[model samples]
Target: MARFTDDNDADAEIRALGEALAMLRRERGLSQAEAGQRLGMTSQGWGLYEAGKRSGLFRPDVQRRLTGALDATPEDLALLVRASSTPSALTQPFKPDGLEMRGRIFEGAPSVERRRLQLSSDELAPWAAAGTVLEYVPGRWPRRDQGCVIEMADGSLRARLYVRSDEVELVVRGAGALLTIEKIPRVQARAVSAVVARLDEG
Candidate 1:
């Protein structure tokens, strides 16, 4: 595994905004297609908002439409906006093999950073709820139909079930959305990690 630390953070900001939109949409149990229909567009159009191809989520009209579609509060959007500047805690030096100790060398290393995420959407409702915390182990990729987090270079992160990969893209299905991303270009992502467990905050 190689460490990705680019001097430019523009891509990072866009990813943050997109991740925010996607998270909010999932929280509300709305798929991109569903949200797009409400907004009078196609799923791809709606996805652009979450992909950071579009911008201004805080604009008056943008907020209105997003809020209407996702049932999100203005404060939620504010928090997402503020997250654009969030420094990633996941950054660590890459060690292809596990840390060398007195005995044996660990593969992929226990040094793999574990990320914790709190659910904020209903897209994966029934199976999961808002405020549920999920733990992910990087380098431990998921198999077919397994839940995992897809990390994108834009800094946007998506939690979906792994489907399959081809030359063009990697496919995944959203747990709550019952939605499939048929083609997520391989270039857009940093890596994928398995979602090993979920923790309830209550």
Candidate 2:
């Protein structure tokens, strides 16, 4: 049994790949400044490559030299190259702050007595989605024929409210069906509020 003693051989393989390329440049006994001259990098920049910092490195040409200098088997060099190029997921911690909150809806409506809502995508299925921020603006008195958002008595839906002279109605455009609330008397028709803007869209 070939017992491996090094615990960090995997990590070392990656570092070895990086160092092997650097060693090839140095085997000519060339100073970093001399290597830098050939590679079009500053001496300090080349050192970052040897240290295995991802940003500063010889890049593609390093592969050419690794084959020559280390006589590294293609399979070995490939393993190192793969390890070097691929980032360790553990090294990058899950940083909530680092995440970008894009498509993030914010309530922009300014109202004195209005409540804002933040609902999940699942909460408002077929209507709103996750990251949907809603600003509940007080409804203006319903106009004759303009589109308005209104709350129902049971508060089942906040839909476009349409008004006729003697009839109150909510026109829901689905299944090619329309709902007319003409049964409710003008005196009893209650308009809770209207949605001024969709917070998610804005």
Candidate 3:
């Protein structure tokens, strides 16, 4: 009886972790296939982890590798699980600017507006090649070295790697031997969206 109880507890924990992982991936605007591609794995392999069928997920190193691929930490997963269990956290009505809410029936679902773009030039090459499709989330800030798409006031879209930003200017890197800095003034950019995944054509 004791052994059965222990097995049930472990199963429950694994399921909770899987749910957190799925939530984090969705929050980053990545589908299972996209997330799997980042880790050089198939979507089915990644799905096993979320289905609580991959026992290796309990390993510390495995947890780090899986979560790191999502740009999240193991600690973040734990916190998410705890927060999800709290009723107030689910009922919170906070909504971010420039984000459109969907699936109103499902409370606490991430309010993300994902956009797609195809590269027409090698300006962001090696990191992203021409013909590559990029999935980006609008209103999400990009971390250093991450890809970003800047929408100009004139309706042109510029794809570059994020370098840094200030109140006045946003610094980005274009294709070059040197890490060239292309600065765009805040007023010129209508929106700066983070590129979450790059899908290269076969």
Best by lDDT: 3
Q: Per-residue error at 45 for model 1, in Å?
A: 45
- Per-candidate TM-scores read 0.43, 0.26, 0.58
Query: At residue 194, what lDDT does model 2 achieve?
Result: 36
Clashing pairs in 1: 26-123, 27-121, 27-122, 98-109, 123-176, 124-176
Report RMSD (Å) for each prediction in the order shown. 19.0, 25.3, 8.9
User: Worst lDDT window (10 residues) for model 3?
Assistant: 102-111
* lDDT, candidate 3, 17-37, per-residue tens: 888888877666467876888
Candidates 2 and 3 compared: the better one by lDDT is: 3
Question: Which parts of model 2 are misplaced by more than 4 Å?
Answer: 1-11, 55-62, 65-202
* Candidate 2: clashing pairs of residues: 121-129, 121-130, 139-194
TM-score of model 2 (CA atoms): 0.26
- Report, for every candidate in turn, its global Cα lDDT versus the true structure: 0.68, 0.46, 0.82
